[model samples]
Target chain A: MSLQESGPSLAVVGVTGAVGQEFLSVLSDRDFPYRSIKMLASRRSAGKHLTFQGRDYLVEEIAPDSFDGVDIALFSAGGSISKEFGPIAVEKGGIVVDNSSAFRMDEGVPLVIPEVNPEAVAGIRAGSGKGALIANPNCSTIICLMAATPLHRHAKVVRMVVSTYQAASGAGAAAMEELVLQTREVLEGKPPTCNIFKQQYAFNLFSHNAPVMSNGYNEEEMKLVKETRKIWNDKDVKVTATCIRVPVMRAHAESVNLQFEKPLDEEKAKEILKKAPGVVVIDDRAANRFPTPLEVSNKDDVAVGRIRRDVSQDGHTGLDIFVCGDQIRKGAALNAVQIAEMLL
Target chain B: MSLQESGPSLAVVGVTGAVGQEFLSVLSDRDFPYRSIKMLASRRSAGKHLTFQGRDYLVEEIAPDSFDGVDIALFSAGGSISKEFGPIAVEKGGIVVDNSSAFRMDEGVPLVIPEVNPEAVAGIRAGSGKGALIANPNCSTIICLMAATPLHRHAKVVRMVVSTYQAASGAGAAAMEELVLQTREVLEGKPPTCNIFKQQYAFNLFSHNAPVMSNGYNEEEMKLVKETRKIWNDKDVKVTATCIRVPVMRAHAESVNLQFEKPLDEEKAKEILKKAPGVVVIDDRAANRFPTPLEVSNKDDVAVGRIRRDVSQDGHTGLDIFVCGDQIRKGAALNAVQIAEMLL
Candidate 1:
């Protein structure tokens, strides 16, 4: 295929992984304009062939020279790889939108969820003379803030309690495959294969496999607590989360309880969310219909439902909601692509 | 088989149901003394045979006269059946331990968890020649309070927020078989059967199927809210809950956040739960192991783990815990059987 040679050149890091493949899907789905595109991966996958945008491209192993002429780079490799190559790509004059935790909390890097904090990357653009780094928020954090930010803007949230039903996709492709294999093995009356996770992931759920921090909160839960503070630019807003991995495939569901500084009735909150971008309201009290992970598996918008007043809180100062979103779409790849689009 | 004639005459209501069969298992396991036992069910199941304590007995249809000379009766039938037969059993001089929601919130009927509030049934005995009624708490409530009450007793919890991951068994044996069948059908690339629940239950989760009240909380969630206040005899305690149904078979998991009036550190809370009856702590931070539903499938003790100080609250005035217990065993049949043991 011949290149159009009319837009900024792009590079996709970790081109063979789950979120990496999703980046391509989202880019093509949105008809993203690119003059040229480079497929980059680890040394083991360097010679593999991938089809993107009706063009056959050979994957090149990531190296310093890989980003020499790139204008925008989307990185979804693990933290160690991003820690080593994210800066190198930036130093080579490419705007790096990293989908790893390596630079999320760093002061210099802007943690961007385009819908919530697009202004964080204000002066940075593609085809610019200078290089920059923009970090993508964690999958859980992105999905949560998609529904929470609009409400927070209205009543000024004071405290939030979240309980997550996370999917296997958050752990990447291997873990998702393991869940399927384990489910089949369990059904066949054989022992489930227990790779990727230490315990059974077959008809059962467990606390997230993330390393537990010293304070008894797993690293995944701490990401929700810390990233919400950074993304909202409000350190005083209290957040606590309990993250559990269910047997679902590729979407995450959350039960969120919000306490605001001022009164916000459920009706007004629903109106605000219905107008918010990248959010869909599925609250149907009459039909008893609400958001489910399967309903949002491959969709872009986050679905919010179960909108009601928190009876435990005084009057109307509190509201509770249930939200579900595709972990790989809106949570990771689509959000990162949206940030890259703002640069155009 | 001949009657023992050494203890109270017993009657088991709804003997063909899930919890009904479990009631017999728990009775035999504890070697509960019964001079004579009657297996009673609806007319459709009459003449069926049920084996208990190595003796086979014919199931009888429940009627007003079925409770004649019956010292105690355990009821696992639905609310309507219980409402119809409970008063009849009581009028016939039988002490009734009903597992339905028919009389949980009644004025004079005592809702009992043998470990939490045995004294509420004070002066009520099996052979007292007078009949009485007792109600069993909901499964989720029984599992959550089993862990929370110990800490609440020490620090005096003022508010509670709970989110549940409930199993299929809470619906019935038919629902459990449906889950297994739906799982197999889904794996075979066929559509899942959605009979017991309106939504697919193979690898998905949804909000509880309990009817939503005018206040927007479902009956299951409200049960937690109202039962806590009643069980603790504290009208001022505030509680909120979000109940969800997951795909597990016979156990439920709950994530609980509690705010207390007095300061209680995590270490002290652990110490208290360690000594508390019907509670087990499985917190192993280094191993990243916590309470999982599969681990407590048929166990009597409710397992508690992921114990930590709530950083959202200041100075140990709050705590977070995860709990799991068998929905059929400790949550229903075992609990009712324990209440019957108290009568003896």
Candidate 2:
């Protein structure tokens, strides 16, 4: 049979999750090939009917036998769920592309951002008669590197300092709902209900809700620091970040400062970004318009703008750029599907 | 008359404006000594009545002769009004402590942040029978310098990078109200009302509404850069900033990266900030609590937290810090009032 007619069997673990639902949209948008598909979620979300590319499927509760006869499984459940089911799926003869943080740093598992480091998962493919696991980076890290990696390839980034204005969608769909509800209540002169977050999330911004590590950086910030080093394969590359959760809905905006070993002028940098794949330059200084979260909420390409020389660094060795991308798509589902596409 | 019985006669310009109203509250909170006070606004607000220090005063229209008997004039109307009236107030033999950007960069005009550079306006008193202009630095500059100056004094900052999360209050009282109104409208499935700001600000954040300069940095970002140099009296210091307006109410938070000429450990930096005047340290990593805009709203002190060594720089020459201060209090009115208090 032709490759198109005999595509690999697929299963979507955590089919009812935020990113999991997005995986279906991205898959349909790209018209990814799959011979057969199964839906899996927790017992609470089981039996839920979901439509994917005009086919109806009922999500079944995740179990040891769920991956039987499946060739590829996309997992977007929480970290604990991924840890419990990822190895089991691989043992059942299926490749797992996990959207959780469970196996991202595992030595044997390949952490990939298809556009940045596709070679990391070169030999891992569906229908190879062998099972393997590939890890998708954190949402913020995926969004940030989509812009920085191209620049890094040119200037050899020696150090990076990032400050993020993340959106509520990074937490989950439930958190986004709470943000809207809390905002409405606060506007009506009522006290806000803080459930997903410890503090008020309406009309105010705060540090990311991730647990703080002993080094004073939260887990989200550390993810950016550690993930960048591993993905770039540079153990000595220095990184620091401060991640904040703003009141935006779906996209995240970041202010990035880069110190490079080679000089990169603003004009050259702008030219490079304009030509880089998966990057849209929105640097319109005359119009006073730059990359904003609202403009890139549901967009696919990561927008880069406000490109300028870092006045703080002497010479042309430093540059600053602002970026924005959809947290659910480019940050999670879209990236995972792109890796799966390469597998075919 | 004894100095205690009769103090400087003060005039509050733009008495009907938000910062103008805040001037009254801060003055009363501190029980600032004054021989008498005048409430001055435009002809539009000439008939408005304002109560301060248990006394109700009618707002008066400003004219050339309004400063004839005034010892010190606190100006907060706008740039145009300050440009026309600041010099007139000074020419009328009164010290003009301006809260506008009109004279912040002028030669011989002192841009003072009491916590950072009280010496900038040294030996200038309101009752000296001579006119002078003591400029109140921009609100963001005052808040950032309050934290950076303490660390700079010890290590001598050579370069600084700042990313600001500003609030709606910086735009004015109407902007704050508009943010709340727009958020409510958007939540109810209605298009947001874009009166004060040109874009939707309810569930969104954007680059500062300040006009973007030719260098790709907005006017607000430039204010942070230029004002820091003038306040610190360090023309050699390099600074760059990206300022964005978040949906918070009255306080602003900033993430600052500082590169020092001398090596200052994080412990010593924390100790210095704890003792620094007008600064409160809130670094509690265990609780995942850091300085936030809500906690610092309407408060006088600039809260500094998240103090850590910048891993990007070696030899302890770099540090990262987060700071929050009431945009109306420490940023504008309180800083102006404190500058005026030095005249006592």
Candidate 3:
């Protein structure tokens, strides 16, 4: 299909989800080229009406036939749902861009971050399935690797030890509400019930929220470790992560220590990160200025700061940087929409 | 001295400060033996009356002679005051347990974390001008080493990567208040300002609060690196840490990944951790139960769970443990008082 001739048709699966909603907003804001829009969800949300670009559309129950006339499909539902129905959506002639981890590590599938590896998507149509499935990086990894990948181009990343300060949005809409409810409950002098989380999410922090694997890494931490390696396509890159959930609602923050294969001066490191795409440099030590979740929440650009050398090593050429990005937008929704836009 | 015999009096310096007040509470709660009690502070807080042991004591200005009859003096005011008056307190025949980092890392002085290395206090004596300056470990290090040291006893320690979810109390009382005030401002639709912290302390989490050294490790992160080695007394211990402040108040939590010289099995690791003193085993994965800040905030014992093996590395045992203990108690004041108990 020529860009000037037939416009693309987009289908949003899991239209009622947090990321699904972002897909709608990004398509509208970015003016993605689309002839028709179809919204699909679970049977419970089917028949619900939503409007995009001033046009009303009905949310239909997701089925094999849902993507018949669709050119692209965005999936942000759980992994089980994606696993059960992703191939069916692709079989119906729609290229699927899945946000879940279902097909992320599959050797045949392409795991992509548009800014990092756009060339990987060129062969999306030359696959065994009807359409290719592109995996979106995990929320924390997407936020950190966006800033790290640009720096990695200048210096080969030897290893990264990341500790994430994640927001409730990474867990989902229910976890977000749990934070609010738990906060209010604590304020009202009532005991907080650990429903959405294993512990109280009000005025508290936990090292692990997702189920911990036998590897001593929680689901969240493992996501950061694996997804970053896949997106950067550097399997030998050593990445260790500790993911923690804080009481924040939106932006996710990561403290990253990157050891370079060769010495890179602190000044050159800062300069490289400053000119990086989709990154805002905010390193002012005298003014106590640095990238923070409070500043980056709801913002599009990933904020990077605290650029300095790592002192523990004798040679001391390694740099430490902190990155913060909105978990909802750039991390999930906006990234998925950008993938679809690549095809357009 | 017998229990009924008169002993030299003890002084609590900086009684109004965060750690100072906690020392006062710990002294009484633990029933430390003292002939008399003297509460001391700066000029601003002097003359205020504080009650301990059902008796009121006057807060006096910290002077060179304030340690006249003080056999044991606990100091937490700041580094400068400790540097200026620590020797004077020692000259007056007082054993000083200094909580500040002033004398820590000094070749002559010993940094004591009672749980890790109580024998470090054996050097405390009255005759030397050294004044028995026992240093307390940094909060993050205190929490991390508490969990790892027990594991190290069974397996030789080699490398450790820890990510800290630190509480505002680790900063000071003002930082705690700033988190509360800024959170209220954010909820009320007002843009919160960074006052006590470098950025908004409310509804946010960020990594680089302490000065990031030229080595890429922030002051907070370096504390974890240096202090962990000191407390464990193993310079060969390779430690990499990322310290982050979350929207939490009192308890400091850590996610630790430790590599042992000898690989460990899960059952043996659990058995060792279960019998470890000051450590509570809460690893019940089936019921989704684990140690949490809400359960350990006011407690002295460090709560640990998620004991498992490292799937990422071969022949390296990994345990995903979440540890939480009151920063004000175990991390600072109570720890200093515990060191004092060793002296008496």
Query: Least accurate stretch of 10 residues (summed lDDT) in model 2 chain A?
Result: A1-10
Q: What's every prediction's RMSD, in angstroms?
A: 1.4, 2.0, 3.3
Off by over 4 Å in 2: A1-5, B1-5
Better of 1 and 3 by TM-score: 1
Better of 2 and 3 by DockQ: 2
Candidates 1 and 2, the one with greater DockQ: 1
Q: Write the per-residue lDDT of candidate 3 for residues B1-344, one digit (tens) a residue.
A: 21224554678878898888888778767777777777888899998988777777889999988888677888888888889888888877788888888888888678887888988878675334345567777777777777788889888778776767788887888888888778767766897877888667777776747875655567888888888777777887888776778888888877776678887876788898888877888887655567767678767888888676654445546554667888898888878888887875
Interface C-alpha root-mean-square deviation, candidates in order: 0.8, 1.1, 2.8
A56-152: candidate 3 lDDT, tens digit per residue: 8899998877767677888988898788778877777678889998898888788888888888898565123357677887888889888888778
DockQ for each numbered candidate: 0.77, 0.75, 0.42
For candidate 2, the docking band is medium
Number of the candidate with higher lDDT, 2 or 3 = 2
> After TM-score superposition, what is the CA distance of residue B45 in candidate 2 from its true location, in Å?
2.4
> Can you rank all candidates by TM-score, best first?
1, 2, 3
